[model samples]
Target: MGLNKITGILPHENTCADLVPMAYFYDVLKNIQKVEEDIINMTYEDGRQPLLVHLDMLLTIARKYPNTAAMCIYELKRKHLKDTFEAWWERNQKKIPKKYRTGIRQNADELFDELFAIKSWAKSE
Candidate 1:
């Protein structure tokens, strides 16, 4: 269905509205990759590779957060993100609090992994 690439949302705005539409876009990305994989069927140059639709955007954020290792291009990577749960908690436990962490289950890696998977769609952040 034409990949249905109607629009994209700010990945990390996390506002009520910004997040809602992203779910649909991810689905579209998955389907397009699937179809492309079947058509090319080449391991060396597979459809599994996601093209950066907007080079300018990627370059902008890339320079802004030169060392950013966030999952997505537009999402700004935090500077103090830690790798171990203990380390992260040491830094955040006070601000976020242990009581709040009581029933939570993710380790630092998993937590940060999903923390900024998406990025702001705004021209500048």
Candidate 2:
């Protein structure tokens, strides 16, 4: 199949708002699954170091679709993805480059705060 045909099966820009609920459900689940797979495949001596590439991917997603990112975070917490991530962080924190560690932790804390705020607002509505 052509690239266009492949992209056609995915949700379109116009339908994204309507797909928010599904995005919330599936995005977090998929991330969790992918992270688990990465952990299993890791062969590093210090264990699976946190994937800065994954973090960068998330930042790109957040920039392009802020609402979807919020929804995904909401689902992540609801589905216990946060716990999984925390466990991963604990396993890999020490292995992260010292220069990048502080910034990564700050960004992660900010993301958690933003997600929690979004979920709280949603519940109050």
Candidate 3:
């Protein structure tokens, strides 16, 4: 029923071993925006939400391309989904295989740290 329950059931990173290119992920993120908008505008009959689906996509992406997954987080933050993204990350980080978590954490820290610093600095101006 809840987002956690829905996303908790999805496949883990280890299960997604296919190599996904960065461009493919970029395209997927672009297309997901439309679905996200629709989900935001109307109530879903099946109780599913865009964020839940997006989280699954992100996990798959992270499995193949952790750096690209970091970019997806940037995209989510750009779309004002920071809180949701953070919650999703917290909920699913443990579900990701331990082997992949190091790369994911490194990529996320490298990408988001600078971005967040700049955002904070801009807000102060």
Question: lDDT rank, highest first?
Answer: 2, 3, 1
lDDT of 1: 0.37
| Residue 32 displacement in candidate 2 (angstroms) | 4.5
Tens-digit lDDT track of model 2 for 48-111: 4344345445545555556655555543443244555566677778887888888878877766
Give the winner by lDDT: 1 or 2.
Answer: 2
* TM-score top scorer: 2
| Model 3 C-alpha lDDT per residue in residues 1-125, reported as the tens digit of each score | 43233223423323232224566677666756665555445433333335545545655665555655554445544434444445446656776678877786666555444334332112222
Task: State model 3's lDDT.
Answer: 0.50
What's model 2's TM-score?
Answer: 0.47
lDDT of 1 by residue, 1-125 (tens): 55334344544433344444444344443543443343344332321122222222333344444333232333332222222223334444455445645434343344444434445454653
